[model samples]
Target: MIRHLVLFKLNEGVAKDDQRALAGAEAFAELGSLIPELREWECGWNTTERDIAYDYAINSLVEDRESLQAYLTHPAHQAAAGQWREFATWVIADIEV
Candidate 1:
């Protein structure tokens, strides 16, 4: 199995409460049902107030690298990512588990 994790930080001058940020986060949360290649999906905004913490995160699981690739390349994922690209920067990790 593959575990795909993402950590997202809102860009400078963008507030967590901003409408664009909220919509982008909501879009990411909805991707689980929209993307067929995801076997599991969990994502949300961070509740903790910490300087080192990211504003949002995604934890997803897929069958294998191919499925992971499919999830990455999926049009729904692209649209959601595009929304985030406007207000945040993110990092990701893919692990075999």
Candidate 2:
């Protein structure tokens, strides 16, 4: 299995507390249901706790590196990728499990 994780930081003045955070979370949470190749999808809001950071986080599971690559190249995902530029920052990592 492979784990794909991403943290997004929205542009200043665009995210008003939890509004954008919630919206983005909801969008990502629906991916597995909407895209069959996505084995799992999870989204979360960043907390103020001293040990936590990042505006929003998402984790997805795929079969392997190839499946992960296919997921990224899939049409549904390609469409969604168009929205990433609107965010101020994005961090991602993919690893085998």
Candidate 3:
């Protein structure tokens, strides 16, 4: 399986409580149901207040690299990611397990 992880940081001047941020979070939350290639999905806003902490995170699992690629290029996933691209920067990592 491939474990795909993402950490998102809101851009400067964007507040965590902003409606756009909430909408972005909501969009990601729906991805599990929207995409079929995903074997597992988990995402949420960060509750901790720390300087180095990202504002949001996504942890997902897929069968293999092909599935992971499908998940990444899926239209639904692209749309959700577009929402976040407006006000956040993110990093991702994929691990084989």
Top lDDT hit: 3
Can you give the lDDT of residue 24 in candidate 2? 51
For residue 6, model 3's alpha carbon misses the true position, in angstroms, by 0.2
For candidate 3, write residues 1-97 as lDDT tens digits. Answer: 9999999999999998889999888889999998899999999988999999998999999999999989999998998999999999999999999
Clash counts per candidate, in order, are 0, 0, 0
Pairs that collide in candidate 1 are: none
Better-scoring candidate (lDDT), 1 or 3: 3
Model 2 C-alpha lDDT per residue in residues 1-97, reported as the tens digit of each score: 9899988776766663545455555556666777766788887766754434677777899888778878888766765555545554788998888
What residue pairs are clashing in model 2?
none
Better of 1 and 2 by lDDT: 1
> Alpha carbon lDDT of residue 33, candidate 3?
97
Off by over 4 Å in 1: none
List, residue by residue over 8-84, the lDDT tens digit for candidate 1.
Answer: 99999999899999889888888999998999999998999999999999999999999998999999899999999
Regions of candidate 2 where Cα sits further than 4 Å from its true position:
16-25, 49-52
